[model samples]
Target chain A: MLAESLALSAVLFVIGVVGVLIRRNAIIIFMCVELMLNAVNLTFVAFSRVYGATGQVFVVFVMTVAAAEAAVGLAIIIAIFRHRQTVNLQNINLMKG
Target chain B: MQPYYSLYYTFPFYLFGVIAIASALAFVTRKSPVTAALWLVNTMFSLSVLFVLLDAQFIGVMQVLVYAGAIMVVFLFVIMLLNLGHPSEIADQRGRWPTLVAAAIGILMIAEIMVIARGKVASRFQVPPDFAAEQMQQYGAIGTVARPLFNEYLLAFELTSVLLLVAIAGAVVLGRRKDTRAG
Candidate 1:
């Protein structure tokens, strides 16, 4: 059962990684990153069943960090959109050097 | 292995597991940001169910409250704010090379997880007998989680708050409109 859950978590994580690599929209990429973070949280909770509440504690921290990342990341994305007028990655190559 | 309890317990796990994976796949493939965010919310709810099945009740609740509730709302707000009208314009522009590379990396990750799942890597970390009963007796669910957060992880807890404050400030700063007249 644990192994099955862990396998599912890995699959989710891989999907998130693929989303990040293949997607162009910044918001979608950010959502994919959130998906990856949730996958890690799932793994932590699964391990907590074996090792106790320590993994759960780590998940809280991960959640905190994810919230912070979302705030700062979206802000950056908004700022970028304001300047460049587009959130597509292919067009925002100001630092092409 | 009581048939009734085993069947009852295992059913939801499998159910939510399938829901999470399916929603996650939908989330990544959706061209519209709002639709993608909605699918991610579905994934988050399914994961919370999985967490609850794992006996991390507090984490599960927090997953719903934080991930599905607050964070997803913020994402939706941003998506609406951006007003990305044309989905076709911002759709995936990557060539086949990225797809192939991503597939290779994903295969490597699955292989690594397969080894671990097969108990070839770490067999010593098996769950102790009556772990659920022992944990319930020792600290209960919420108490067990709170003790570490308030005691051993006290400094980290405080630091996380500080980090949140800084993040808030940074977001405001970055998100503010620049004064063109100042230059």
Candidate 2:
């Protein structure tokens, strides 16, 4: 049963990764990153069932960090949009090497 | 008979699991950011159900309150601030290579997980019989989680608060208007 849950988490994480790699919209990529974080949180909680409450505690920290990332990331996206007038990844290439 | 009660108990896990995966797929595929955000909320709600099923009730409630309520609202606010209409125009403009690579990576990950699940890698983490029920009775759900967060993990908890503060300040600084003269 736990393995099944872990497998589900892995599949979700993979979907999130695919979303991040393929999607060009900055906001969509951010959302996909959130999806990946949630998948990891699911894994932590599933493992917490076996190892006791430590995994759940770690999940709390993960969620806190995710919240912080979302805040700062969205702000960066807005800043870029302000300067470039577009959130498309291809166009926002001022730092291109 | 293979214990009919176990089937009843495990059904919701599978149900919520399917809901979460489906909603997550919807979230990533939607053309409009607003629509995608809504689907992501559905995914969060389903994951919260899964957390409760795992006997982590406090985390389940926090999942809904923080992820679905607070974080998603922030996402929607940013989406609106950007005023991105007609997402179809900007959606998936990067040709076929990214799609092909993403699919290949996803398939490889699923295969790896299947191998792990089918092997001894998953067996090492087995829960002792009655451990979950005993823990629930001894500490209750919230108390068990709170003990570690406030005790062994206290330093990390405090650091998260500091990180949140820094993120807030950085967001304000980055998002403030540089000048009102041009408008």
**lDDT score, candidate 2:** 0.87
Q: In terms of docking quality, how is candidate 1 classified?
A: medium
**Candidate 2 lDDT, A1-97, residue by residue in tens:** 6777799899889989988988889998999999999999999988787678888999999989999999999999998999999889988898886
* Model 2: fraction of the reference interface contacts it also forms: 0.74
Interface C-alpha RMSD, model 1:
1.3
Which DockQ values do the candidates obtain, in the order shown? 0.78, 0.75
Clashing pairs in 1: none
Q: Which ranges in model 1 have alpha carbons more than 4 Å from their true place?
A: B1-5, B119-127, B180-183
The regions of model 2 sitting more than 4 angstroms off are B1-5, B119-127, B180-183
Expressed as tens digits, the lDDT of each residue in B13-124 for candidate 2 is 8999999999999988888888989999999999999999888899999999999999999999998878975686677535698789889999999898788767754566
Q: How many steric clashes between backbone atoms does each model show?
A: 0, 0
**Model 1: how large is the Cα RMSD against the reference?**
2.4
